[model samples]
Target: MVFLGGGMPWYAQFGCGGGGCDRIRYMKVVLQRVSQASVDVVNELGDLDPTFDLQQIGPGFLLLVGVTDEDGDDEIAWLAHKILRLRVFEDEQGKMNRSIQDIGGEILSVSQFTLFADVRKGNRPSFVGAGKPEHADIMWIKFNEALRSGGVAVREGRFGAHMRVGLVNDGPVTIVIDTADRH
Candidate 1:
């Protein structure tokens, strides 16, 4: 079993006996119902690089996503299905009865490995639960594609890049989903 830099065994954790990652723990997503959302790349000097504007969306979801070593297509498929059809938007009677698909909403997805930050020990957070970069990047890209396959417009922040993300929460509605909770 080959361990990565942080003393986390990537090879042992993921049962990639053949080639690709077929199993996973949980593909997590922090979904915020938003009236607006945007993500811009941060330059080396810790400033927003106007030229590298990744994405912005109006009236949709601001998704902060994290992946685990075991996360794979199942997690991606489950999350995409749940999020796209989630009925958080209001209907004619001012009740939350509409799905994002119903309102033709958009999605601004950002790769957020920090979502898995482990703060159990001390002041410093550990990312041992986070997916290795190679796997996470692949799964994240597939997840976005799955979301797009739902027929809603989707935007994304650059993977593995330092980004400044901003959003205006609509209804202040927020949800955190972890596939581990599946029964």
Candidate 2:
């Protein structure tokens, strides 16, 4: 499924400075899986751009979830169990034998409004009808807790942070799940 990390605004580092300033340092991670998987993370600081940080983590996949008005307790519960149990990685015997729990992998869930960005209208995207913060926050917390209860360590990006994200697609086997589709 699609997951998003809410990041700090790109302008937060500059305070009041306008455009074309030096880029700030931030973390952007993307994971792809099929028979094999690769994760790429860029640390936006230092002279070396697109720095690789995947070596620090273990064998695990990242889940990107989008929050909407229709997402609630049940949706969170279902997704938590499903993602944690998904057997995408192989075990010692060369069998697909590990879940997120078995590998001690954690998840980073971020609140993303741009996931719902409507591009059909014009060059400028429209997010006029996204879920309100009140509803989105409740679901966001519930989803994170549900994943945690399944024995997966979880870390998260800040909510409503303006962030610059970079992703590289290896296998291109991305999955998108809609909470509304469950109902």
Candidate 3:
């Protein structure tokens, strides 16, 4: 058996055989049903950057997304479809039975790698589980494109940029999803 990185055997963790590791990829998303949402690009010190801002959505979802190093199209596709079709909005009956598509709502998608923070070790969170900036940018762009192509209007946060996200979570409905459990 071969070991990679730390002391653990590589095959056990990443499913490596002889050639390479088929490490499972995952994406984490926190979805909130929102009456309104917006995003603003900012500097590390939290001052807004004048170059970009997504105004606000009248009604839709605020999505905070995190991608793992191994995440790819498979995770992106599944998540995009799930978000668009998730039945958390209201119908005429006032029950949660309608989807974003059913009501023609918008989406505010934000790249939020902080979702992968591992706080088990101490007070300070570790971000080692999060995907690198370059790969995360690709996944973020693809996610927005997927939503658009699937007929949902998507407003996005600047990929790989520091951002401030603001939202009024409708019904205070929040859901956390990880692609690792889907299979």
Candidate 4:
């Protein structure tokens, strides 16, 4: 995925001004092309659960997504389609020429509000740029659905929960997408 035009876009706008998700209008996502990936939810007692549908994926993407208060359908749509079409997987010629859709890869999406962590002030990271659950949840649902609509299997980590994630990065091919920088 080429930073902006491809891959899943998680939303969270660090306002061009102000504090705490102030709304500059951009979503952030980190996509890691993986040979295998799995995410387990942490139960109320803080135990990791590996039995859900998201137990494991053979070859696919581990999508860490975030969103802001102002993110909407347009951003979601654009990113999903790009993820479905971006050609990063190897083709018959071993060239990075096949898309996830072409290879029938799955997606393990996890809500990652920390993508917006800001440490500009001090040693501690500030999460002021993360969107609130109410709005971000809706965006998360739509983003996953949008990926599923493209004909790939989609799995998810428990939203807003403490969990353990594991993956074997393929090609170590990682991508970072920020809507503000892209479009």
Candidate 5:
């Protein structure tokens, strides 16, 4: 099968081989406004497991970041800004007028490559749209650093590792951002 985009799996269309995802592939971030959030990182290498209680931010965000091969610095920078500046939290007037920074809130970022799962062909999901581990890992770190540099207190799950993420979605406010749509 021939997948129209780059980096699509051979089974994506009808007759296809191997290549990277499309140049226009998007970096996805799933954001949920949260009253509380935490993550436990399990040692997949069978070494030691650690749980990060992190800081107790009464209100904040839980971000599930999905990176694709085509995603890079521009995507990262844009996403970081958007997440930090998004005005989902309510103000004194009960209006959605406060950014995370405005409310002194924290951020919990988790690497979620599965966000790119494609199940069009069968019940099994295909991760062909996700970036390779080596590249994705670097991008993940870059994203966290970017958020920190933006003055947002950030906590993270172990990248490329098994993690137990728990959160309470405040206001049940959820949003999905895709880099492709921005362009």
Candidate 6:
């Protein structure tokens, strides 16, 4: 389940206040546990927003989480358990039945605050929907703990830091899961 967005396309604009220049649109690709079995997140920062582009490379699953100020320990636990149990892959018999735990995969968890960026009433994006820095940090730590407690070997990008992420996709099998959907 690879999530991609057709972001603003770049075009040549000439004859303005100063001059025109060519610009390439910015895009992000989040490759989760496509090479491993299970992925988990204990907080909302792990969540992926609608604009996020996620690709599940190889055989593992990609866990996209959306963090908010309202997120708590309960939400973190639920997300971890849900990611481990959600079956989106096919089994040996060609049946769509295999949870992350059943296959023993790895997870690539990224801290994406942009997932909570809201643009309801203005041109600029609003982060009011995302959790506060202090709260999010605590939740982020707990979220990873939940995954570890569930016997998952999680590989995560740094939290609250701008990171240059890169991935080499093999099988290109991507899936998206949202804990909020269960509610």
> Best candidate, TM-score-wise?
1
Q: Which stretches of candidate 2 lie over 4 Å from their true place?
A: 1-58, 93-97, 164-173, 180-183
Tens digits of per-residue lDDT for model 3 on 77-96? 89888888889988888999
Candidate 4, residues 68-99, lDDT tens digits: the string is 88789988988898888989999989999999
Compare candidates 1 and 4 on TM-score and give the better one. Answer: 1
State the lDDT at 54 in candidate 2.
32
Task: Tell me, by lDDT, which candidate is best.
Answer: 1
Which lDDT tens digits does candidate 1 get at residues 1-183? 667788876765557444444445577899999999999999899988877856889999999999998988988899999999899999999999999999999999999999987675689997877999999999999999999999999999988999989999998999999987764
Question: What is the lDDT of every predicted structure here?
Answer: 0.89, 0.55, 0.85, 0.84, 0.84, 0.57
Give candidate 1's error at residue 182 in angstroms: 2.2
Q: Write the per-residue lDDT of candidate 6 for residues 68-176, one digit (tens) a residue.
A: 6777877787778877777755689976588777877666666677876556456998766566788777777777788878786666655675444555443565545
C-alpha TM-score for every candidate = 0.84, 0.61, 0.83, 0.84, 0.82, 0.63
Give lDDT: candidate 3, residue 12: 64
- Candidates 2 and 4, the one with greater TM-score: 4
How many clashes in each candidate? 3, 7, 0, 7, 10, 16
Query: Could you tell me the lDDT of residue 77 within candidate 5?
Result: 93
Best-first order by lDDT: 1, 3, 4, 5, 6, 2
- The residue-level lDDT of candidate 6 at 114 comes to 80
- What would the TM-score be for candidate 2 when compared with the true structure? 0.61
